[model samples]
Target chain A: MENHLKNLRAEKGWSQSDLAEQLDVSRQTVNSLERGKYDPSLPLAFKIARVFALPIEEIFVEEAEDKK
Target chain B: MSERIKSAGKRYRLEFGAAMTFYMVVLFGAKFLADGVEPGAWLTTLAIAPVVPIVFACIAFFRYYGSLDERERRLMSDAAALSLVIGIFTALTLGFLKSFGVFHFEWDMLWFGPFLIALWGIVRCALLLKR
Candidate 1:
């Protein structure tokens, strides 16, 4: 999964720590999500959507099959 | 360092500490009682007395684990799985070597629990540090 988390966070002028606080997760989780090193569960995806006030698809894009 | 995780960590530490302290006391007490008791069911029961506090420690550990966020939980579960795999492979190898008469010393089963825990701790630290 690819996410515009970094851009979104930057647009909000929120540090990783700030986003983590809002999400009730550790900064490591935020970093991992941004780096595409980890995928969020459904609840966490909903939480992220809620945090950014955007739909989950807007924040997270599925990878194209050809790209794989 | 969310407040929730912070509080959970504190509770885990307290619970683990209390359990470990009790475990040590039970160990020493068992040892003291062992010398005065005959070889019977009493001694057998005394031998395993330390396991009681260990069970509480395990419960505390599970509770702390349940309080972790999803990503941390994934990492922890992965670390535990790796530890178990490594521990099992090592035990199997040692068993095979012993059966082949390549090793003579008895492997202390008591060390297995600590070994797995230490391996998981090391793996978890490395995984977190890599992040």
Candidate 2:
């Protein structure tokens, strides 16, 4: 899944570690999320959405939508 | 990392260390006692004494595993699954070879634990590196 996590973090001036802290996850997880190498679980996706104050759909685009 | 995860890691280390320390002590003590005894129930009891600590170590490992995040847990599960699959195939192949007189060596059952663990570590490291 492609997500706007990197761009959103950048906009908030938060480093990966800072975002990881907010998400209560490891920095490596944050890095993997940004790199699109790993997808978040439902609860984690909700947490990320909450942290960014955005809906999950806004942050994470569906693969079909992304391909379009 | 989260404080919860950090504390989990610390607890795992402490528990695993304590268990392994006890295992070493019990193993050596059992070996020493067995040397002075004949083949009997007493000797058999001495031989399995180290298993108590090994059980504790396994408990510690499972508890630690429960505390990991989803991705980490997935990776660990994958590593363990792969290790078991590979280990079983290898063991079966070796057994067949031995039966066919193509292989000749005294393979101890005790060595399988460390072999599986080493394979798990190697597979886990490879998965991590691939990410």
Candidate 3:
């Protein structure tokens, strides 16, 4: 999966650690998500969308579709 | 580590370090003291004395594991399951190897811990790399 989490976090001037704090997750998780090295579970995806005040679709997209 | 995990992790490390130190000291110290002491079951009991701190460390591990959030717990569960599967396969292979007289490694039970740890690491890294 591909996500616009990096851009969203950047727009908020929140570092990965800052966003991780908001998500109640470790900084490693935030870093992994941003790096696309890890995928969040549905609940975590919902939490991230909640944090960004955006729809989940706006935050995360299928990686296959992203390539096109 | 997360804020929630940091304290537990520190305690776990402390306990693990103490356990390792105890094992090393008791192992070698037993060897040095062997000549002077009467040969008996006391030596066998002393050899296993490090298990006390090992038990303490296991408690610390449980605390640390309990402190993880749901997502982290999921990842850990995946890693542990993968490790167990791989560890069992490796042990079975080693057993067959021994039966065939292909290899005669003596550390039968000792291989499980290292194999589990190694496979857990490989699975974790593979999971990370895949996403």
Candidate 4:
């Protein structure tokens, strides 16, 4: 799954470590999420959405949905 | 202040200490404590002492597994599963070879625990490298 997590974090001026600290996860997890190598669980998705004050769907996009 | 003390790594460090205590005692006990043992009762007791710490290790590992995050737990589960699978096959082949007169060695239960630990460590490293 592709996500706007990197862009969102960028807009907030947060590095991967900064985002990981905010989310209480490892920086490696944040890096993987940014590179689309790992998908966050629903609860983690909600946390990320809450951190950015955005809807979950607005942050994550399925490949087909993104292309459309 | 690092919060890694609460991590699975710290949990396993304690577990490793427990395991090593059992391992060293059993592995070397028969050599050093070979004297002053009388008859079958004490011999049997000495032979079974290793099992006590092994049980503690199993409980420690169970707690460690339960405490891991999803990704780390998945990786650990995969490593353990692969370790068991590979350990079984290795034992089977070696046992068969020994039975067939192709190999001659006194392979006993004493070696089994250490073998599994070695294999599990190797499998975990291999899995991590693949990732």
TM per candidate comes to: 0.92, 0.95, 0.71, 0.75
Give the TM-score (vs. native) of candidate 1: 0.92
Q: List the residue pairs that clash in candidate 2.
A: none
Would you list the C-alpha lDDT of every candidate in the order shown?
A: 0.92, 0.93, 0.78, 0.78
Considering only chain B, report the TM-score of each candidate against the true chain B: 0.94, 0.94, 0.75, 0.75
Q: What lDDT tens digits, residue by residue, belong to model 1 across residues A1-68?
A: 88899999999999988888888888888999999889999999999999999999999988893267
Model 1, which residues run further than 4 Å from truth?
Answer: A65-68, B129-131
Q: Deviation in angstroms for B130 in model 2? A: 1.3
Candidate 2 stretches with Cα past 4 Å from truth are none
Superposed model 4: Cα runs more than 4 Å off = A63-68, B1-8, B11-15, B18-39
Top of the candidates by lDDT:
2
Which has the greatest DockQ? 2
Chain A TM-score, each candidate: 0.92, 0.97, 0.93, 0.92
Residue B106's lDDT in candidate 4? 90
Is candidate 1 or 3 superior in lDDT? 1
Each candidate's number of clashing pairs is 0, 0, 0, 0
Where model 3 places Cα greater than 4 Å from the true spot, the runs are A62-68, B22-48, B69-72, B122-131
Model 2 per-residue lDDT tens digits across residues B1-131 = 77777889999999999999999999999999898798999999998899999999999999999988888988899999999999999999999999999969998998999999999999999999998
Candidate 1 has an interface RMSD (Å) of 1.5
Pairs of colliding residues, candidate 4: none
* Model 4: interface root-mean-square deviation in Å: 3.7
| Model 2 chain B worst lDDT window (10 residues) | B1-10
